[model samples]
Target chain A: MNDAFSQLHPAASFAFFVAVITLTMLYMHPVLLIISLAAAAGYVCILKGARHFGKTLIYLVPFLIFMSVLNALFNHAGVTPLFYLSNGNAVTKEALTFGFYASVMLSAVILWFECFNVVMTSDKLLCLFGRLSPSVSLLLSMALRFVPKFGRKIRSIDAARAQIGQGSAQGGFIRRVKNSMKVLSVTLTWALESSLTAANSMKSRGYGAARRTSFSLYRFTVRDAVTMVLCAFAVGVTAACVVSGGIYARYYPSVIISGFGGIPALGMAAFALLCFLPQLFDAKEALVWRRLRSAI
Target chain B: MPQTVKKSRVTVTLTVIVLSAAAIAVETWLWSSRKYYLTSVIIILLAMLPFFARFEGRRPQVREIVLLAVMTAFAVAGRVAFYWAPQFKPVCAIVILTAAAFNAEAGFITGAAAGLISNMFFGQGPWTPWQMFGFGLVGFFAGVLFGGREVKTVPMLVYGFFSVLIIYGVLLDTGSLFMYSQEVSLKALLAMYASGFTFNLIHASGTVVFLLLLQKPVLSKLRRIKIKYGMLQ
Candidate 1:
């Protein structure tokens, strides 16, 4: 089943991700970082299967650790020195902690972008920006349409070459590269030659002679409205709390987090809700399906 | 027609200069605020806007649009064909050839389009804008330097090599810096560049190789098409 969250209007999903990613980048608080990271992972697992998510994690975890260690080694800015390398750069606790959290922030952002890719498809992006810049949108659509066609053409050219004993596969690396270039050259000529016909066809069709109208499959329903409003409210609360010093952190000379109080707690809760909103929707949909099956 | 062409050229140039200046201003502010990713992405997008605007305002001939689309598709296809060779793609070389055969505007549009479309197959990420900007800048510069000129294989190959190594490589490394290492210390940046050096070298070599092999044919064909269509003049 299509995830319940992705069924919302593109605007809604786009807004939620923008808010979540922005917050993830800005917030340095460990608790908030963990919450954002977990939420991002969970959302991706729901969107793509857990196996794919796991493969991504296997690649990302080492990268995360490497960045953290590199940061600690290079940045000697903090007060509490844990050790000193031969290069005389003291490994400070604050710097190490800062690096770890910063890496976490980076990981969370990457995962969120993964989710963004899944949810904000090319069609959705085209729909969102089509009217804003019709020429750019048209170029994107045309170029995208041609990419697959060109790929197929390249394959055909390669096959024809192979039949003529000029396959890229039978040679040394340099020879293979040269043979491939031969195929590409043929494709290029054909593409350029065919483009004239395409242009003539477009001209005859009266393209760009009038203002363009775009059609999108998505509609902003009441559910989408609620989602947008809730996301905005959560972001607003988080921003306000951060500005008011209710949610504050420093990891330069030392790690200091502001006391968890009424406003700060509320802000954290709101942020958490915003992060897990997609998962909640997915879970609700699963539960509904379960109940329907049981009733049947 | 010549007068109008000159007029549009002036407007496009003016648009690019003004938007770039504004982008620099906003980039300074965002950099100060440590909003690295947003700053870079916004700056790149702002820089690219004028090209798209020029295409729109000029209401280019159908052939012009088709030429741009075809070249972009070629670049994307080149990239896909060499997917097994990491960082070894002919995108830059193709962009350079397109620019040299046509004008800078065509080159920039082709490069930017290729970047965006290729990423559609590869999956878009935070790196998309950077890749788009980097590839576009390489094409833009190539057009400015070599457009409508005889593309000597050696000089063109040299340009492709250094450009892929420096322009595209540096921009992407800066992207990695912002995304992976939020801290923008000189040391961190150096480290990042160090890690990225081999990849950049491979990418640059790939461009040089492609340029060496494809430059003569690509240029001749493109020029032939230009003569045949009598468009993009």
Candidate 2:
């Protein structure tokens, strides 16, 4: 599943994320919210496995509940009063429902970002932005690469310090903090010195002598083109429907939801398709692989 | 070379001012109408536009790029290194030092890049953009206020104190306010700020401690490196 999604052109993948995440954040209709949440969760499970799904749910459920409760307590702008808070504000059904919608939206967006972190590899990001902003892209990719390298350096430094009995663990709280700062200062100095050599290496390589060119493995293939067109079509239709007031809901003063009918239904179907496009690709790839395996 | 550098610096400064002004105008309009999603997207794009403008005018040498990347990475690593200390990280101080030693442009890029890359491990969400903005502004102001100036510990510490307040106090609190409420209200905003005050204080103290302890050594080393390499001139 991961391989299937990763194999798509970076542009296509980026478009898919932009479309789904934008809609997930903007579209407040209950139907669209549910669809987005389910699709985001399903895709996350496919990409990250079930263990991560459980972990995310554990964190998100409480947060969702908390948000809903907070809104129910504070916001009293509704006709349907469930109860009155001690502050004399009514805990209205409309507020609770709105809170629930917000929670779902927040969770769905977070899930999409988690998927994005997995799918949008630094190299792919570089590929996407390199042509548009070469120096910024270079810096971004370099920063991404250096994070883990710096982490390793910190660990090694910590180990060296600990062996000499001046480690963070070898003292009281204040002393430990001081010790850690010592290690951090050393790492900062080392990083600065090493950067000079790095700069010199680039200088020797004739970097910035001319506009830089990079080797790219990704190509916009037929599949990528089709997927992008499909995604764009779905996004366009959904946006048109939204602008046309097909997917409309009101949570303040009164909880009013527009009737689900022709255009709203079509818009929802398109949105669901948009959110599920990656999963569809993953499923198709798996089926093909399984068939080929059985034949062999 | 110096002229070109100065020209680009002027252009970068102008772009930042223009974009921020535009963002403020957009934000005012959106807040009145309550378009939170659009506000988020617009602000993030606005925050990032200066980087492209700055680099587009004059392509940064690979040396500067690598150095900026390494500094960003160190800032991020510093954040993770102090994970044991809740709400306390040297990231803000590192960003301030980077901006002071280098330029505002490098400072903004380093802060933004660090916010983004660190969120990969910490978890990315809507808060990510606000975090990036908060940190980026810290770097930008540091550069704007203290760029190419002699190091003074007291002023740096004061700046660090306020920068942390803006980041953890104002920016993130506003994010929660929007996330939790459909409609904006003064009471809710006050409540949100009150709730987040303790955490912001911790973050502020962390920034101050890191600045007080690190400003001299880090700035001196970076200054010496700049002289030796003729960098960020």
Best by DockQ: 2
lDDT of 1 by residue, B79-146 (tens): 88789999999899899989989878888888988998898888888888889888988998999989
**In model 1, which runs have C-alpha deviations exceeding 4 angstroms?**
A170-178, A284-296, B1-33
Q: What share of the true interface contacts does each candidate keep?
A: 0.72, 0.76
DockQ in order = 0.65, 0.66
Which run of 10 residues does model 2 chain B get worst, by summed lDDT? B30-39
Computed on alpha carbons, the lDDT of every model, listed in order, comes to: 0.85, 0.83
Tens digits of lDDT, candidate 2, A81-199 = 99887778888998899999988988898899888888987678789988988888888778878888877887799899999988868889888978877887788778878877987
The superposed Cα distance between candidate 1 and the true structure at residue A80, in angstroms, equals 0.8
Give candidate 1's chain B TM-score.
0.88
Q: How accurately is candidate 2 docked according to DockQ?
A: 0.66
